[model samples]
Target chain A: MEKKIAHFTIDNKECTATTGVSIINAARENGIFIPTLCHYEGVKPAGSCRVCTVKVNKRHLTACTTPVAEGMEIEVDTAELNDLRSSVIELLFTEGNHYCPACEKSGNCELQALAYRFGIMAPRFPYQFNERDVDASHPKIYHDHNRCILCKRCIRIIKDEKDLPAGSQGRSIFAFNQRAKKVKIKLDDRLGKELSDELAQKAMDICPVGSILVKETGFKTPIGQRKFDKEAISLDNSINLKAMKEAHHE
Target chain B: MSKPVIATTSLAGCFGCHMSFLDIDERILDLIELVEFNKSPIDDIKSFTKDCDIGLIEGGCCNTENIHILKEFRKKCKILVSFGECAIMGGLPAMRNDIPVKECLAEAYLSGPSTVNEEGILPNDEELPIILDKVYPCHEIVKMDYHLPGCPPRADLIWEVLHALILDVDIDLPYELIKYD
Candidate 1:
């Protein structure tokens, strides 16, 4: 059966998307940018970060989790929404010990990239400087609790594969331990021990911050060459390229 | 009209930010034409002869002396700029923020791998500045009018902001210039 199409107007621009497609994905298809941190491609939308928020008829909603409705008028790219997004990014910066200068994932980090996109000179909120732990017992990967934003990307993406004799199609190798501020990602000793090098790298890649890192692979990319270093974080690469050129000429 | 007087100091910094400031190269000549140095390490001025137009702070406060110097800059400078990651967010020295002050001193003076002091004595001189309970970003101690965030903020960024401030123009920092690392 053919999927029903949903027509929407984002920022007063016409857009058409299949019913049930997320507002964020639809906006992306329409060449509109909605910044996100917790929402990862090919993974379930948790609506945890609230960075991709959009206003619909005076109601605020997470674009990543909210499915598009026919004739829906989505309000994005407004000054109010941008400030809201920037504030969310600032809160993340303050709540966590994001010492970007010393972080191994400094240049490539998505959280840091978002801050740059928003021109956040400093977080308005005072730094919490929370004392978090580093779990390095696993030979393949180490989880730096200090940098974790509780986005749950590793927990959702890095799961046991199907077709193996163990045959647990989606058994999570990482799980949440404790609660509230004390909460952290706890690796399953049984499954985490059997993780391959490729999977270890995947876990690190899946993480938005410098929380999960592959052992001994720090600083592989030099400054000015890392991801998000030379380039601005944007859904539209052409726009960024134009900005880059203008900046270069100056 | 008198040129704007600018002051600079590194509290607990690695001096990398100051090095980046000098990376402006020949642009330094252009800068000198626009601004004058006052109470800055660059000129080795021991005290502020007069009030400064701008003060560029290069690091966070980790000791009582850092606080004193920061307060002095606040009182004397019309505009205070946190010039690097350290001054903006406590940078690397703040890594010990989680550990107790006593424990940090013990590790540095007693338990660290290389220690020749058989007597197990920690430095306690009257002249030495007392370490703060925790490293604090300069803004936490005093109002900072501007902040340039980077490991040692890009030299071009330093030059551009200075250029704009001296000329009384809007600081339009390009996207390529803003970086956290």
Candidate 2:
């Protein structure tokens, strides 16, 4: 007898599949769309920005983080769902200093495209304007506190993929003061210091908003030419897994 | 069997709600058949009886006019639903309560950007009602039968609730839709 599988809906289209598959991946496979913010396939689902909120049965859920169940009815479009998503996107604009006029990642930015797509005419809510200060720590990485949505994509890339101390120093998980306790102690031995500028750049590339920008890449790629960046960013799934394993072993 | 008589009104709101209701698209006919919307401004119905099955009061009661209208609905409707987040949680209008009433008045009248309140604009004299310290939900002012929580309650959810009400079935929240952890 065959094992029973779960059913997940993608943009109102339904499909039956096995477990251990994310809705984002399943939807893509079935030619359905579930737009994501902090999720890159084969990398990790950060569930930040809350953009891909699809209705499961009667709920507005983040399609990336939410696991597929045996039977789920989903609705991906409607005024209410759009309203909630649009409001979330609007909140992202209002929460920080996302001034696209001066942004480094302006054209290559997902936030701007989504805003255009959603017809965000103006900022409805008065800007909270958190007045966040910059973090000038890394030699190459310039932390513009203003653009940081605090999505922690850099943190994930740093910790999981690159295995670096700077990535492990997230405020929510580990505060600024506690940086030296775990990963920071290895700093003295230069052997574990494999955090390359390219790795950092990839993390920056994965960032949906202009929160993370490669200091050099800005204005080089141009706007419309950098289309592939917006094209479904799934990290490890389509990459050379063998090379990744060999790199880890050495 | 008489259909549900629904009366809808807006107070201190942008009326984006009524606009959103029209956005339901093709469902408006179904909604109309489900409920007898006799007093909606959209219908241009000037007069309606208080003996309504469902009374959906949008916006929050700030002035005497709102209070009077709320009381009238309470006197008339059987089920009073605090429609939008303003009616439910006092919304952005309610958020103004965070400031001192004196400061709010000062900003509106003198220090504000527009800052000019003509005779009709300014509520002058002792007769002018004092601002409440904080915005209270409709539940605080009057008994609410059911609440549909949203900035503006989703048209689909509203439709579902109305359908359930008409069928005498319960409007239950599905667990899959909420954030537990």
Candidate 3:
């Protein structure tokens, strides 16, 4: 069956997308970047972080969860939207104990990259400095609640291996849950110990912030060579090209 | 008119930001020509002698002395800039924000690994500035006109901001100059 194509206008630009594709992915395909923290590719959009909020038919909605419809009018980039996004970033900064200088994921952190792109010298909100715990009980993975933005990326990507048969390949070793305004990610101790180095690194990479880190392997890369140090996080190839131009100019 | 007067201080900082300021290399000549230093560590001036056009503050408020000096700067300077991560967000000193003051004092003076005090006594001299309950960023205590964030803010960032402020021109912060760490 042929997929139905939907045409829409985003930020005064006409774009075409498939009928059921999310506005974020559709925007990406058309070279319009929609900044997001929680919506990872291939994972179902949780819409927990409202950074990707855009106006849809005069109503504000999360672009990651909202499906594109025929003749939909979307406003993705505006001064108001940018202000809202910056505020969200500031709230995330003040709501947690994000001491970037000491974080293992300092140079490569997505949250830090967003702040850099937005030129956030400091958060406007009052710092909460809430006390949080760091769980290093697992052999490989370390969870620092201080840097978590509650994006739930790890919860969606890492599955629980408890129910799987013994020695089953591709079993998940991480578990996470939210309760009473508190959210936590836990490692299945038994399975976590058996996790391969590659999988452990993948878990560390999956985390947008420095909340989850692999033990014994931090600051391996020098300051100038880290991921986001040379280039900004790009949602699409066009954005990457733009960043490349700026980097070249610099 | 006379050169724009600039004052600077390090409250609860490591002086790393001031070191980065010097990292502007030979441009120090240009800075010296552009502005006159008033109450700065570099000039060895202990107190503000006159009202200044700009004040560059390093580190956050961790003690009574920090708050007092910061208030004085706010009153004496027309524009106050938080010069580094410590001044903007308490930086490394903020690590103790989670621990109680009593625990911190005990660890530092009495029960710490390197403590040599046999009397188990805490320092309570009138000369010593009393420690606050927690380290606080500069803006929380007094209005901060600007903030430059870095472990020590990048030399280029400091240079650009200072240059712009002196010239009364709008600052265009390049992407490479901005960093949190």
Candidate 4:
């Protein structure tokens, strides 16, 4: 028999079976949720958003990228983790143009929803509310680079999952003006509306923020009509990773 | 000087978002000491009146009633907030926009005779509405002042929106959103 792994209880739910998955994935598999500001199901793990930060044996680690272990004690929503999450959220508010009300991806925005999840009812930091360009170069998709959180999930998903050309991966403002060698190798699928439908699905689903929203379909549905509201599903976890990936791709 | 009168409402959604509000739980009581849910399905009251300092509207507008409700709130609420993804975009319902609206309806109400049977047709209740050929973000219909974007608006966002509204403080997003996807 294999070596037995330790167990953990989140609000009393036994989460020991997910010993091999990440903390966030484990939590998600077991119906536990950790707020994430910059994470997606279809993409590779990027621990950019500190919102999923959890106290694993009193040490802070991002649930999105951190794996689970046997007999490891973890606290997801403690005062320290909550404060750290809040600080991370406050920073995002200041960095980007997250004008929730006027923006298109308001109701179903991952960033906006996480704010509500972590109880960031108020933004303590100043809004770096600068005007960022909306790269609507592609007819089917519109990406507001200003709102990007630099999770690189898009780049990873395209390169790692879909096996697309490197250029199709997006450019991050943080890494936007990086070395020239990097700029030499980028994917640019400048196709027409023939691929609009497919592009729209991928872009919208990949964006954790309201950045790459689908055009023309804004506001047709109201906020109350979305999913994952009552229960928090930590995308960083692997327990439900299979289901989430299937649901995400579908 | 006046206190912010807050109200929340939902439309063509699973009500999971409205349920997300409950994630705050006891904190909501603390929130309510100042703000009020003028016309929330879960909160007290019916038929949203208007003129709220902050209005957190969840879900997207899928039917005539949804359109009416969105317009009414847009007019009445001083600060109209698109509370959830449905409010922001059409969320999953909008996914059907990829298909024909009629086909979507047929697939649900008619495709399967066993589920759609009885008197050849069970009268359609106005509330159990049909979906559109496409899904959209809320800004297409009305002007939104603040947005809490999420499939289910985050508990952090709920707390932060409330705090920003009440304390009148500014907020900057965390480094994570910028650094990651």
After superposing candidate 3 on the true structure, give the runs of residues whose Cα lies further than 4 Å from its correct spot: A160-172, A236-250
The DockQ-based CAPRI class assigned to model 4 is incorrect
Of 1 and 2, the candidate ranking higher by TM-score: 1
Ranking of predictions according to TM-score: 1, 3, 4, 2
Quality of candidate 1 docking, DockQ: 0.75
In model 4, which regions exceed 4 Å deviation?
A: A1-4, A9-14, A159-196, A226-250, B1-181
Clashing pairs in 1: none
Candidate topping DockQ: 3
Could you estimate the TM-score for every candidate? Answer: 0.94, 0.46, 0.93, 0.50
Error of 4 at A62 (Å): 1.2
Model 4 TM-score is 0.50
Query: Which of candidates 3 and 4 is the stronger one according to DockQ?
Result: 3
Question: What's model 4's lDDT at A175?
Answer: 27
- Tens digit of lDDT per residue, candidate 1, span A1-250? 8999999899999999889988987887788888888887656789999999999877999998999999899999899999999999999988889988778998888888889888899988888888988888887787888899999988887887845666455788889998987888998878888888887888898688999999999999988788888787888542223333555686
Q: In model 1, state the lDDT of residue A81.
A: 94
Candidate 2 lDDT, A43-159, residue by residue in tens: 567787788888888987787787777677767767887778778877887666565545667655666555545545444455554455455454545556666665555555444
Q: Which stretches of candidate 2 lie over 4 Å from their true place?
A: A1-4, A8-12, A160-194, A228-250, B1-181
- What does DockQ give for each predicted structure? 0.75, 0.02, 0.76, 0.02
Assess each prediction's global lDDT (C-alpha) against the native.
0.88, 0.60, 0.87, 0.63
Residue-level lDDT of model 3, residues B1-181, one tens digit each, is 8999999999999999999999999999999999999999989999889999999999999999999999999999999999999999999999999999999999999998988999888999999999999999999999999999988899999999999999999977878778889
